[model samples]
Target: MSISRLSSALVASLLLFGAACGDDTVGTSPNNMTTPPGVDVPIPMGSKLQHTGQCAGQVNCQVDVTFNSSAPLQVRVIDGNGAPVVGAAVRYELSVGLAVGTSLNAASAQTNSDGVAQVEIRAGQATGAAEVIVSLPGDTSVAPIKFVAGVQPKDSASYSVTFEHAGTASLRDIKVFLYKAEDSCDAIREDIARERDDDASTNPVLTAEYTANGVASVDGTLPLVVFPGLSNGQSFNVAAQAMSRDDGEVELAFGCTDSNPPIENGNSVNVIVRLEDHLPRLKGSFDVTHTFSITDAICDPQPNGGYAGVLPSGVCLAIDLIGRLATDPASFILGEGSGDTGIIGLIVDFLPDDGILGTLKGAIESFLGNSLIQNLGRDALNEFFATWIENNAPDWVKGGIDITADIYESLQEFRVNGIIRIEREPDPTLDTETNTVVGLLNADQDGNRPGKQVWEDIIVYWTGDCASSAPAACRERTFSATDLGATSSVVEGSFTGTVVPLTGEGETGFGLIINEHTLALNYGVLILGIIEQVVLPSIFGPTVTSLEAALNELLLLVLPGGTTGCQGFADFMVDNIGSSVETIARNLCESLLESASDGIREFLTENLTISGEDNFLLATPTGTPCKLVEPEAYTGAWIGKPLPYIDGLGTDSMLCEWDVKIRISQDTIIETDGTFSGNRTGF
Candidate 1:
């Protein structure tokens, strides 16, 4: 046998039977599937109606039907008027090519305890129709049979808390403070460092305040949290208990809210804390732990460089060690050169709850491994220069510069009307003043600045009004530069004698006119520098390194601890250099648009889609698949759009997540026209 296979077996053996083996985890059960309700649909051959109808005449084929049931899904065949049909041999036919129906492939299930049966249709079957027709058993309403999956609890939490009093001894006033795991850390740190009860703090930081009287006198009930309060679809359910009234041995579940809190339902392990009064045994030998496993969902990355500059609440930090690590992780940016490392100034107080990092401040400084002080000052000032260098792309001209290339090229219209063949209709009768060499001046005597002079002013006239070409906010549209040279000592001209007024009715901002005048090129190096130095870095990787580090800290403080057997939880802590950022960015994007679609189709069909199929086009706020504001093309630079990112993925290819993930091809796309009109108070 191959080494890999042998290793896998050994690991499995070790894990399953406690026998010497390799590292692979043993597997006995597969992922769970929804159990359908008890049904008695007899299969004449198979339930696959695909090829069984009439398409199996001239070709070989197989059919497969996946029966998706909620739960406790079983079926029983019954005769008319409430009688069970016994030993009914049912046959079925199935087709394999299309989704309209599926092809069947094997033995059918027979009714057991709950009156249920299953059937499969195989390939190369006849075109004849076949089915197991059983009589109605009885009115299902009375007994009310159902195919319930037993899934709910989008708003509830389940947890068990145990408190152990001083073994055989007892004390009075056993108090347990249940602060929000959301802000536990900062609270812990602040409570530990500061000496006050009242303080004003900004930042509506997440936190919960719950207190249960002493469990000392031998008994007391531990409280379970259901909500932490912010409801912008935001949710959290984590616990933090105070350590033993004895030496930290009587561990209290607490949180350092700086890091992300344990996922809403991500605790796959249970936290079993047994209280002990013994000195050494309780101090070194006892292990406080928990076992928890969660649904595939809810396991998501935190948003916006979590806790970058936020002071974690003590309640946030008191959860578990992993939570600590999640809240506090080792992070660094690979620099390009000395001093070139971009700087990340502590914006301070990611979440300035009570401004009391003052208490928790030391803890945060200790936590960040940086030199920042909380409440009293800042907490952990780790200098992480941006490794995110900005690269310059072509200048992005604003101010309606995208006026269509065609329109622009055509704007070169230089009076291409009737040729210069003056039909003499140009007042051929009137006397025209030709520069008759009004004589080249004598540079020696008439030293009047020696420039060409037009001793007269000419006026050009036209009729009819022109179209308005200004956008709404163009009134205060003065020259966008330091100054406008319009009235400067530049060459001035007129249509009359020596000068000309740009007369006539025409588009106000239509075109430029100049004669014998020179134009200055605005290289706009300053603007270019701003785009490269400020725009790119700020937009793409701004303070990313430090923020990532801070996020790692937050994740450690919030996610579950090593008490849980899951690995890579730490890896999940730090946002590594590459795809790490991309993943966070994508998930954030998904989070942002969650309200728009909510992946309804994916939820409906347990399978992810390629740009979410056409049938799954997520609706916008108005319940439309991104209706155009004007029947125009989708031109908005949406984050991710269904675009041709991958080929050979078959037809029906659409851009998934807009332009981000392109490999998936299902011919469906989430489109956005970036066209938004909103009112803002500021300029």
Candidate 2:
């Protein structure tokens, strides 16, 4: 049999069931047929026509008539003397507006010996109200009898949605929407966007909102969601979002009923939707502000007036030797020399014997190390010092100098800034059954996907003479590694890592695992610049000049005869020796700065990298699960290991830490509703 015929037969069986269950008044017309006054016809006296059977008085009654079902209509005709009018014929006709295929089982039917005539009013696949007309054939005495029936789809059912949240946050409200089974999740998302935007024209098949009070369910059920015009075996999809507020911040979670079961006749299905932290809702860029301090105990003051901890032991030894030679020139001289009997010859001969040359050279070697001294060779350094003594020895003797006592009392400040971009993976690993996702993270300089990029700047301010009213007397300088210049600008770097879903203690969220990342800044060159431009000029220059003046004064007092000439000779030797020593120390210190900078960079990188799992609860305000507005701000702190000493010089080092604050905002707004006005405030 054809599908339409089979449907008709099934509907017919349902109608029979309705009749057997005493529901025959369903789909019945209210009033019976009556003869019109204008009709001119000859009728037998006392003859009457009326509706009979279980479907009587069912005219235009408000009731549902299942599609392809028939409504049985029975009528009786009697003669004038109240006797049965056997063999009388009755006709039936359906008015327009009824679906096509709505018809009578028989156009005409003869009355039986009991004076009864019957016909069936069948419905069609569409929904609308139509009247069925009954009349005696070829007789104008009785006007047409009308019976109304409303056609509707079969197997239509309502749905009761139940929301579930595993987190501790109190749910404020849940919005649910239904779509056709063939519609993709993206399409449903677009519809949701329309609703969120308050678009009046866009409508879903079914929508419901449930308000909660510290719970997602009320009496284990919410409002029933009904979709009209649904037939048996037709499926649909359900999309819902639950919203909660905590500490003045809004949080949103999503759930979907994918591959929903088909509708069954007269069934009220219960659908359970569990909310979770989906990646798409959390995708965006965040601006982070961090403040951290790097302190070295070696820089701190000691009980002794001398800074024994500030400079390396080797450097301290070389400085002390030079100081002794300045205060007592007679003791430094070993013996007289042949080619040049002047103070310069005596000093040169005294250097190798007193082991001052070896001591200074050893200090320089220790300061620079092998890796840093590769370009500045030791042979070249010795040659330069020897050549300096033979030429331009008297110029350094005339200058007077003073060393700043509070040279080490200065403060160093570091400023850092960055953006953290979160995006969906091209091929994300997900478990639909558990609603879990394994998200990947990496440092892509191209600014794509989930990654972190940072920029940093360093500044130094001398605390000496801060009590002076003049600000210029208090020295300050900013250093940048990028161009090796004094500028207050940040240099860029990146961090590498991964974020994975975490579940424990009945709570779920994401955990950030940052790999050991090396900063892109050139710490060696940066430190080298600071040492050459600031340290050498401000501190070492004065120390060298002071030593030269002291040695000249000492020579005048110690020489036996011809004090004037001896003083001049002493001046030349001290001047040449002091200038040469200063130059060599500067060069060695420069190389040392480079080597130390490398170590500093390594230590800073290790301390800066976050250790262990930075576990954040999914439902908490600080967690990764969050709704992205046009602009969102978050505040937190990143604690790291204590700062380590250079060459293990100090007992304890201050912690290397950062107080992080972030502001997340979007520049481009994507409208899923197809109206790309670009003014959306939130997702």
Candidate 3:
């Protein structure tokens, strides 16, 4: 037998057994009561009444109780005479609107001595208004009581969008997506509607049915959005994109907004979206160059009689010996040319541990030591020593041994300081003409747009020490030779130029010509030493004093000082000799700057390779109504402009004026293979 039938049989058997037991209530049994057989006790009219408290709720639609809180629904009954109706059967029922989709918890309660009854009514997951009913069993005079409440869904955002393609062309079956501002629309959509393989197609917070029809002729059409209920003030990103029969994939438009402003408690917002011609971005490389000329003067010091008392006084130097030894300032161009050793490759990426000085510190010493000696050949040096003895030695003391010479160059310390700034701006005049849009530059006409820009916040930093050999004591000095270590080098600078506003034009639209940007080495000094060895007789023998002033001048020009060899001198060239040590140092720094430019260029190229295939929709201010619509193929070429910022939704911003181009090749078909004459179109 079925469980139900067996339970009924058991209940009936128990009832029969109870009836067989006589006077179970003892002296108070109804059978022992001696009363008139036909008479019946009637409840007073005023005592029959109703009383109740708000019914609490759980998993059902809202009523007097809070949903999921498990609060109890209550009811009370009384007789017509105002006395409590004890032992009365009370029933509680729940009902929901059919369209709203919710259910009620069924429960029954018995009135106690106080005529009170209650049941816990649960709320359903679905949201909508619902009613709870309470009534007594077979009551002729009492009416039922209905307690009503409204259920609310979880938090979400709703949006209504209207789409148009290339002016008045209406688009059908376009897919719309809403997602968290920080998430990807495609990823979110996949999670919401997984494919048959159970793999997510895309992840989206919410999605709507494909648009069946769109009336492009009208300005504002009925909404094509159906979103779940959202809490007030919630934010979301909205994207509407689709692929065309001709175009591969196109981004119509996207925006971000708070649910409160555009979405009312019971109303929807109307968003207008327009599709535009997309341009393919090109991938290629280019070069940068900077040239400069530097010149300075060198001063010579007067000789001291005490240091060279026996020197011949006949030779008079016209200009300072140091100036005479100096070479004319030369012109130098620095940039990235071909490879590491190339002229432009002087600048290189250095880690915190490696610096320019770390590699070139030896170069400084070589330039100071061997440069002048190599220029003055051995013959010239031999004649100079012979002349020194012939011209200055007293006539009575004539005699000179071959003056053995050993030249050594030493560098105790040096420092170099450098700064570089680069920037790019859009052309404000070109806008929406010739299929181009401009005026996205930093401007404030009505003040709604922010004047800040991308480059304004850019901070270029150099973090390594340029001079690792610098003395520890000198390293702390700011802008000094020892201070050549890396520091914050970005300068507050601006660029004024024009980019062709990316208008599907494959030609380079952005061009910036940075002329000789001055990279000044403001402070710091190089300590160079030229140590020479020679022997002189102790008493009346030929002394350094016996040398002619010309030889003395030569020595003074090359060495730091005649008396104190420890003195330091600056390698400033006032004229051009055959070779110049100053020129070499200057060239090294220039090459360093050029290498830096190469690095900066590479940084920009790697960071800014934006393409139409990315399908990113940048925000842009709606310009004046589009007056012309042209359908053309976009050829991917070097536009030479930085990729515009995309997904500017909730940010309340848009892309600067620019053009994007995309090209789709049409297929050719012939009735006969290659020789066919009949016209056919396809690929």
Candidate 4:
């Protein structure tokens, strides 16, 4: 048998057993008692009735019962001393009206051995509140115990929505959705459509069709059930989308009810939704070129005339980036190119570990040829010894050589190129006061709040080339264009600004306001590659060779007499030179790496991303309403103007304004394929 049937049988059996052993007396038997017919016996003085079991005390006094369902009413008889008073007669009375057809299994019951009396109440066809009063028989002075039951309806609540549109297009069909008050309109639309596609039974709450032109109104009885977890008097929101077809192209207008309506049981609520023509979502390709320059000193001068004495004065690095932005599964394609010639900084500091000095000594020795004395003549060796004595004798003669070189290399130009795919959706809400609807660009397609956007398909390329004077090593180490490697860098950002309608000055359309944004780029691999492959070889290869050549010339001028002393001086100079190179390389690989990384990050954070009111406006001719046309295409000029804060692009007025031709179409599907086809221009 079913669980409900089994439960009913058990309750009936328990009631029968209780009745069999119950007492009919007014009071005072331990288990069972009998009273003579027509006898008027008063209940024991100070006796009272107390609700118990499922109806225990005040907390469990009320319960909800569905139609045709039953609930048990229980009570206990206790004396003033709080002890059980068995064999006492009890009376029960259920309220009327909504509880008219509700019946009790017993009108009167005597308390059992435990002084507990119980009765089952079965509800009828109506839905409302019902009360049951329990009192002792012939006890006029004692108060009665009360229990409450709320009768719930058997059917789901219904609603009706009326859609009214002010647009001139002839609507083919209008789809209506019912959502909770807190749900976003964009999420509701996507969720309901997904549910219906997954299951045919999950169709929208209401749909209406119309063939008339201009403004029109249509109403439909919504086949909607109150949302789960909602109760009577709770409110819900209504949203609608009206679609119109012209030739083979389709356009859509949206609307929503201004206020949420409460759910009423067994009744249909009427809601009026006002529709307005909104800007069709535009998907297209855009290109932006940014140029900036940075000039900074790498290392501060140190004490004792150490490595700082040989370091380059300062560095000036310039960068140029061409970025392409596209919508309909949003993406950014960045192409890096050569910048103006300037000094690029290459700073190196020695690490505490890793024996960097030894490595440098070996590398320098190999470059200079290990058997220096065998290769040079006696006269050249004498002159080399004399030059070394004059330059290094003061510091070296004092004690064991302890040399540290703080050197800096200047870079002419820097550039970067990459592509990043991102997701964005318009989350719109109605403005009651202005009677207009505005939307915010949500990165994650969520509610009205700011959402984190994870940029995908990020491919960055280092496009800077080595100078012509650079050695073969530097030239061979140039970055390759075809190697598209994946990076773990994820830029956490949000687009929280508003997209509002624009009208005035011979222009009518929409503008998206971008206000203050931050983008982080992981430069670990890129920076290391630049330093190791490009900067080191380009600067050190030429500088070290020139220094060695000068020393060899100076050595030729010395006399050939003191050959032994010359050899000793030559050995000292070679070791100290090797030590200095090693110190510089070690420092670059360790401390300077972190410092450069932080500097680049800070530069991007402060100057790359746009800040303040950067308006991107898509405008059509005045008096021409922006509307989707045949082929679902729109061709116009997009204007980007940054006002107030222009710190991003420095003081270059040319970087403040941009005008580009935008060719967009509504045919692009963002949820599926992210590919787009068109002629790319104006880079």
Identify the runs in model 2 with alpha carbons over 4 angstroms from their true place. 1-156, 166-171, 184-232, 243-251, 280-289, 294-296, 299-413, 417-438, 443-456, 468-477, 483-492, 498-513, 521-683
C-alpha TM-scores of all predictions: 0.14, 0.38, 0.21, 0.29
Q: Write the candidate numbers in order of decreasing TM-score.
A: 2, 4, 3, 1
Error of 4 at 614 (Å): 19
Better of 2 and 3 by lDDT: 2
Q: Write the per-residue lDDT of candidate 4 for residues 85-150, one digit (tens) a residue.
A: 666777888874455677777787767657666677777766555667777767867777665555
Error of 2 at 56 (Å): 46
Any runs in candidate 4 off by more than 4 Å, and if so which? 1-199, 204-211, 215-248, 256-274, 278-424, 431-435, 441-495, 502-511, 521-683
Error of 4 at 30 (Å): 99
In candidate 1, what are the lDDT values of residues 117-187, reduced to their tens digit?
33333222221112222222332211111110111222322122234322222223333333444554545
lDDT of model 4 at position 131? 64
Clashes per model (N, Cα, C within 3 A)? 144, 7, 66, 12
**TM-score of model 3 vs. true structure:** 0.21
Please state the error at residue 297 of candidate 1 in Å: 83
How far is each candidate from the true structure, as Cα RMSD in Å? Answer: 42.7, 23.4, 27.7, 24.4
For candidate 4, report its TM-score: 0.29
Superposition TM-score, candidate 1 onto the true structure: 0.14
Best by lDDT: 2
Which of 1 and 3 is ahead in TM-score?
3
Best model per TM-score: 2
